[model samples]
Target: MEKDNFDEIIRRSIAIRKKYHELEMTHHGSEWTVEEDALAYLTDAGLVGRDIMSQQLRWPKVGSEAELEHKLGENIWWLIVLAERSGIDIKDAVHNFLDKTETVLK
Candidate 1:
């Protein structure tokens, strides 16, 4: 995809999250914590192990392909939001880092 396409997708995702927040506000208007949100996503991703790992994550069933895929897909929205909130354009960041790596590894 082109730069414009990525930008549009990011923008659309932001809007979707904004709408989610709006609906959430209608129920729990006082809640607003980015740290908490990130933690929630981390748990959803099943990366919260050991100190926070649940049994399902530590021991998946033999045919649990869909569960793994769902967990992986679920946390990306939080990452996208984190990048946006930090004023770090992911496209530029990825391109710059890749370019640096390419040059140094050459």
Candidate 2:
């Protein structure tokens, strides 16, 4: 994908997350706490691992390929949301991580 398209997808993901946050606040009298968000993210992340395992036949198949794909996307969405909520720029964090890892590996 083009850089612009990738950037647009990130932007859209962030916006969708913000919308869900608002909905939660409206319905529950407040949005989820950071810890709750972290736990939710972790739950989905664990599911992704399990999905992969199932696909590999290391575990019984409980989920479909489409579910695995959704879980992966959801994990990325959670990462972006967490970074935004923590006042960090996801793009900068990713770039810094890659640069530092590349330097260390070299």
TM-score of every candidate relative to the true structure: 0.65, 0.87
lDDT (C-alpha) at residue 3 in model 2:
50
Per-residue error at 78 for model 2, in Å? 0.4
Give the count of colliding residue pairs in each prediction. Answer: 0, 0
Tell me each candidate's RMSD, in Å, in order. Answer: 5.1, 2.1
Report the lDDT of model 2 for residue 40: 99
> CA lDDT of 49 in candidate 2?
89
Shift of residue 30 alpha carbon in model 1, Å: 3.1
lDDT of 2: 0.88
Give, for candidate 1, the lowest lDDT window spanning 10 residues: 47-56
Q: How accurate locally is residue 91 in candidate 1, as Cα lDDT from 0 to 100?
A: 79
Show the colliding residue pairs in model 1.
none
lDDT (Cα atoms) of all candidates against the true structure: 0.68, 0.88
Q: Pick the lDDT winner.
A: 2
User: Model 1: how far is 90 from its true place, Å?
Assistant: 1.7
